[model samples]
Target: MRTHLKNDIPKFDIVHSHSLYLFHSLVTGHYCRKHGVPYIVRPHGTLDPFMYKRHRLRKMVMELLFENKNIKEAAALHYTAAEEMTLAEPVTFNAPGFVVPNGLNVSEYDHLPKNGTFRKKYPELNGKKIILFFSRINFKKGLDILIGAFDLVQQQHQDAVLVITGPDNEGFGDKVREWIGERNLTDKVIFTGMLTGEDKLAVLRDADVFALPSYSENFGIAVVEAMACGVPVVISDKINIWREVESNRAGKVSSCDHVQFAKEINALLANEELRSIIGNNAQHMVRDYYQWDKIGMALEREYTNILRTRERRPQSFKVRGDASV
Candidate 1:
């Protein structure tokens, strides 16, 4: 963003910004407008309903004063998911918008160590159907709902164990542990503080199912990661990529309801044949859709299209610097 501060910044075909709705975003947009350079904005779900409500008045005035105009005149606004596009307000303001799903770099999985990294560490998990919920222990992730759903899932599959892995955000992990203790799942649930690298892949490789009941997720990269490892997933429909999961038979997408989530998770655990079929399908879908190589080519195409249909630069353009300053 400091590039905008200099009076003599290098010329570029387009200024692509993947920032939140902050002063830096508006400044980048302002520079684009003032210099007649094409710009594209990626809100990365910051414009979603939940975030917009956080500072309603400030965002509203900022949008009117700077963001809206910048977006309206931009080459295009970029969205990572279809649902994100639909959720955007003033949808028509950005005359044209682009949707590009997030891509995964599979190299991270290329040299992954053997499975059971967790099992070797916690020998008690042996012979248990490990259901994993790997994400930050935050309210937005619906960890409580997942715990409730897992309670129901365990009743049907007595040997099933839930492993909640992730760093505690604002001590939410402690809160989740309290919930587990209250339900007498203290023995059934395992909490591994923040998992990464070989350890992360080991857990993903061994887990029977990967579940995330996020209240709102633009794209669940973890879901894709599970699919990449040939593991089935269970996610809430609130995830923007739910359609892709449902259509590809990658896994199940349930409503936010804990009961519904239990039903979906139970279905996968009850039928080994169904699990294998869905798991295989998920792997295939990720190979076909989520590869970073394929996504990079798609982005090249979008940039080419924009460059080809290049608009005339406005000579009289100047930054007001009123709101941005």
Candidate 2:
């Protein structure tokens, strides 16, 4: 990125980054600085405690050395949600920051085809309530905990089916499949690999509930997508931007506990009235906050500020001088 910027000085304002933890962003930000470019860094919840808990030693050292240098040198920091800004403030001595939750293209689903082929593929889901989980399968995502919780949910609602979909990040997807087989839940749980476009919308639109048991998520695009489709979400508080989920009354948020997970899911599943109320709120919340155009305008304003700040300062280019004293 630095080399590319060096080659093509893309005349632009604020060179805002998505995440400082990512090597490319950090490097690019440094280049912008060298060329007298003013930029803003968005941590995107990468500094949350949940992420810090994973590689404590390495992360701590990086923070003290390179990471701190790169971030503290920026003009400002951009955060996607309140939790991210709160977690970031004490960790670094940097310029001011603001929250801008990630947005989605709502128009894409405007003319989506209505299809329930997923129900036909899995006969168990034919006349049952379908709880959808769509994201990469990983330990950090808490899929195992969800599976355990689903067993308890099944005890009460025999008609509910769990549909887990996403690309297999590691071998976790296969392991989950094995788990379902052992429990003889092969008929209850369905796995659909990486869905997109019409298929994705169809599933979301048909779902009775969207369950994301992730251990840590910066911004759950899937959560917003489900809400756009008027599906209530059941997620864990570990998702950094969970405030959006809660304030919207999109669904229930709890810890990554198996029992609590079951309780939340069961409450929503058994009570159709509560589900409808939550689903309505979810759709309203998306229309209010998750629209792509609104978010893009906000970002444009930030970039304009950066450009204005840069223009006010003197250019840093040096000129040759004669040393004839």
Candidate 3:
């Protein structure tokens, strides 16, 4: 899928590519343009200023050569959040946009074991209040900040244990472990490498609080998953969905500062009633807003609108190099 597009590329009403950088999407976009099929571009948070600021010169050159054209020619820009739409609009100009959040199959939360499925496997976590950090172990995801905050959290709450689990990214996991050893926090923190399937869900279900102090996030599907499991989340304010979590009373949002991060973690870990109250609110919000039924309908409506409009005003479809409106 990453290399040449097979001659058997399936016929479709629309060609939707989720990115501009990934080579497969570039091939797919060029193919669609050649075939007169409209394509949709969804940045999935990559268009945010945080990412745009990382490699300005190279990115600007690429945008001028490829990404800019791909985006400008897209039928519509698909954003999971309104903020994403706002961040992406200038790049797309008159290209339309629609918002439909990523959602979970709420039914999956129905029969998860409520008890300590993870604690039973790792008995050391049996008595400790588990604070789970499950995501890519990378700096941008803010694992370093989380470790510093967890070190502080231990001073206030000795019973708390932090579990850092995820795939290593940019060799940051090794750095996190080294930091832990230097701080002599090996006893307070556990690095579980990577987990998936039942292992992932088990920890999320059993953890007392879920934390992802990311520097930037688009939708935060993991936060929503934690909320669906009735586990409250403590996330960074830069997360795009912090407003929803804050408004829903489902989680705590703090800036990337480890001081404030530790404070929120301590508050949730210290109060059982508070955890339960926010956990309940989190579950309700997931059911009410983040469910597949609600989000899928909105998504399907966009698909319908695109296809309907394409058929209605076939002239609206423009060629690849058609710069004219």
Better of 1 and 2 by lDDT: 1
What's the TM-score of every candidate structure? 0.89, 0.88, 0.89
Taking the tens digit of each residue's C-alpha lDDT, what string does model 3 give over 108-166? 88778748888888878878999999888887898878889998999998988998878
- Pairs in steric clash, model 3: none
Work out how many backbone clashes candidate 1 has: 0
lDDT of 1 by residue, 222-273 (tens): 8888888888999998888899899998899999989999999999999899
lDDT, candidate 1, equals 0.80
Measured with C-alpha atoms, the lDDT of residue 188 in candidate 2 is 90
Q: Tens-digit lDDT track for model 2 on 112-204?
A: 556575566666677899988888888778888788888899999989899987888688888888878877788898888888877887788
Query: In model 1, how large is the Cα lDDT of residue 68?
Result: 74
